[model samples]
Target: MSERTHDGGVAVTAAPSPDESLPAADLAAKYGLAVSGARPSLVEYVRQLWGRRHFILAFSQAKLTAQYSQAKLGQLWQVATPLLNAAVYYAIFGLILDASRGMSHDTYVPFLVTGVFVFTFTQSSLMSGVRAISGNLGLVRALHFPRAALPISFSLQQLQQLLFSMIVVFLVVIGFGNYPRLSWLLILPALVLQFLFNTGLALIVARMGAKTPDLAQLMPFILRTWMYASGVMFSINHMLEGRPEWIVRVLQANPAAVYMDLMRYALIDGYGAVNLPPHVWALALGWAVVVFCGGFVYFWKAEERYGRG
Candidate 1:
């Protein structure tokens, strides 16, 4: 028998018998309940992810390199694909449809590229996260890496693509005499916030997708609708003129709209016009924290069952 402290009073407690199991901590490093005192908060969970940064970097590099392993184009496809996307959209929106008629931005191409590139990262992260666990059944069963690493790796891979797209956009901006401004520097922090948002979203979707494989199929459609709603192809402000002020306010409530607005403000408007107000940034950061904390706890609760199916 073992004696243990109790809140009400000292009580005698029986220890596990020889045939019974040891505490969870001794079974597996990954299986123990997070002690109340030592358990990680959402920020700490993200820091643990940061501590395993090498794994995320290695996995992202592997995925990117493997894309061209057998192909002649190799990694060139990364640049080629986004270049093609920009060209197609420029042709359709800038030339054929003349969609930028009354937009505040000077040129349409750079605007379109910035919107599409930034939005693509969100789309890819969510879509890939939905299948992260189920797609890695073999590794999930055989390895003990942090499950969050999977989605983080996927987000990093997409970030690589986003970086390439940014380079291309920069060159285009230079050619078009749209010199980058001091505000462009904000891109880095905006990207960090965007990454946090994606990571949190991936965690939530990954758990849901694992339980219901059908989520994988529906993600693309949801993303498509989300993109349209996000104002990626057009300016939201242009459509809000006749609508109720509350409707426009509600649209602004969408986090993606805030993100893209920040991008446009930084990349095209040169920062002064697009600088996020303190209130807006506070709101965005609040949303990110809520999503990340909510998703982290929700997903952590099911860590043990992720590998079962």
Candidate 2:
């Protein structure tokens, strides 16, 4: 038997005697207390995140500002760093290493610049994802919001940075005699798919980094190797000419290389569908969907465990 208290009819019950036992489920239902750190269902989790859209956008912008606040170059570094790297590659590949592989000077420069800028978006997203949870442990522990926010906001920050750099990319393209075309419209969908892909990658890496923390140390080398293999400074097709057909197809189909090829076909004159592997857009969309759906579920599964350790 129980007596009601004045505080919203909360029950006051006598303590159980040694002979009595209370069912945990019944007690929980009566008291309405959920298990601490319980994960939400996917639909509910997404609803909660949607309720916090302002916070995510604001946080992303704040992080972007803070990243360049101390540097004398400020936001200029975002554009300059990639341009400088492109210049160095121009000298090395175009001149010394012969990575240009007989492509016209105009064509190779634009190709390299667009590839560097586009690829860096994904590279930066993964790098920042590694730190998203680990770097914000204090906030994660103190706040009741979704942990996915951190990784997603980090991805947005990178996206904003890349958008800023795209202006320079267009200028570089114009300088090399590649003007706008109907194909350039494809960049819109291409970038949208890539953003999804990057977000998925960010979520996956954020979970991994939150646990291991050592993954961050190895990412740089991994990205560097990927850069070389992605045909950023040179054409993988030209490099692998006369090689087995399957081998050439495999490299072209890689997500990174596929994205670079799409952008090249869109922005650089004469780099069209024929130069690309079959089903380029289809492969890009497939990778984006698979990675995003898989990554979101993967990260959501670990929601409750993110900040505890």
Candidate 3:
């Protein structure tokens, strides 16, 4: 209540009574408090994540370091692992299946190595993403940040590893007598699109595996099937030649095959327009857009549900 004083027309205000109930808003404002455990809007979440960019990079590098910490050769194993796989594939697909008979022995090794390294990038990114959130529950519980960072950092860790392995890849290309060309500029665009595509897959699977942890186990078999379909070891065009047009289109349009074809066209003399699918760039750009946006939205929709369970 406010009262006027007799002296000099002064006004005085009375304090609230002890028995009067304080308004919730007034109490909160007085205490400078906020809602606990409230989820932010998607925009706010993204902003929060952006604010933590350094943390993401550091987390990714740390994981990359820890990946080989137990191994004797350390980072060399990253390059050696895929190269060894190439050797085995070269044996089976190169020897038993006679897939290498058509291409020059000179470029075929480079072609196979490129496919192994490129595909392994996506494979490793997604595999780590499948476990990103579920595997880091301790950190998740101990911290409060956007869970999306986990998958994104995992994808980045793989990309960093891929770049490291690319040092060996370029050497292998040179060892086989291929030199860098104007066409090699295409590797940037190819890796960019593929990285975006892998990030999308990572987010999609991270959310999925968060709910169904078994996805981690099942992904390898699914990826193995994908590798066969992607034509990592052999030219699928020959096998798909006699098939119906739709099947041929499907095989050619597979993202993994499109990327490998792009790299071969960029890096190898024998693998270009004659074997390339029509509109390869269009197919690649479409896959990147569709998967990345769709997966980001799908993942963001579950922002509040991530660590509660």
Candidate 4:
């Protein structure tokens, strides 16, 4: 309303806004506004992740390709790296230290190589996952996609690298007299289970890394300790013989050892069915399902905080 003033000036009064009756929260709610970067429901988050599956796959492939881009041998290093590590282990453990006291040369060679390759899958996944968020902060901060994708894609990248190395694994096994047979088909399920387990582990570490960037520096020593305990270079059964049945069982049941045992059992003829932990398949399946689901939820619980400083 406008009114004439005593001299020549006019005064105007503003009308009330229609929205004055609504609180800010109610106004936002009524307009379908939400807090940016807020976490979705678990099921909805899973759907969002699934919606970005193609991005996940392409990102993994790109990372795998670039991993060896600067090396002279390029992708050959994927296989050669593990093979060389196997050779070094063979010289030290199989030759000098006599770690293969029970198994013959053929059995020991294939066993060592298989352990190196399988363990590398888990090792690389962990190393990559530990940096998945911290190493790619730009992407994490600029993008709005699921934060889990980075770690999951890194795990997938390691899985792809392992698949490439499997060619050499097959040659090593066949050269050692483990010809392909009906049981060889078990590699599929074993790899699937291992991939799930690796992905779960990756997700767990990614969340940790995002918060504690210093963790990236600490992971190597931790993984090295895990590798040694996992029997990557020798038979746990042989090394721990007489260490008490329960202790041996506990080490054998560790997820890393379990996956390596499954691969060795599937790929090598002389891996000895007798050495396998009881109910090995059940253990593998249980580890895969439990870790993957638990890690997914654990990571999702902190979704909104991932890219924050």
The number of the candidate with the highest lDDT is 4
Candidate 1, 14-40: lDDT as tens digits = 786753466567654545445432335
Model 2: per-residue lDDT, tens digit, 1-309?
Answer: 677687868686777774346688767876797987789999999998899889999999999999989999998999988899899988988799989884788899899999999999999999999989998999998889989989999999998999889999999899999998888899989998999999999999999999999999999999999998888999888888899999989989889998889999999985766669998889999999999999999999999999885
On a 0 to 100 scale, what is the lDDT of residue 202 in model 1? 91
What C-alpha lDDT does candidate 4 achieve relative to the native structure?
Answer: 0.93
Clashing pairs in 1: none
Off by over 4 Å in 1: 1-51, 104-106, 270-278
**What's the lDDT of the predicted structure labeled candidate 2?**
0.90
Clashing pairs in 3: none
What alpha-carbon RMSD in Å does predicted model 3 have with respect to the real structure?
Answer: 6.4
lDDT of 1 at 103: 58
Give the TM-score comparing model 3 with the true structure, all chains together: 0.88
lDDT of 1: 0.74
TM-score of each: 0.80, 0.93, 0.88, 0.96
Predicted model with the maximum TM-score: 4
Q: Please state the error at residue 287 of candidate 3 in Å.
A: 1.1
Clash count list over all predictions: 0, 0, 0, 0
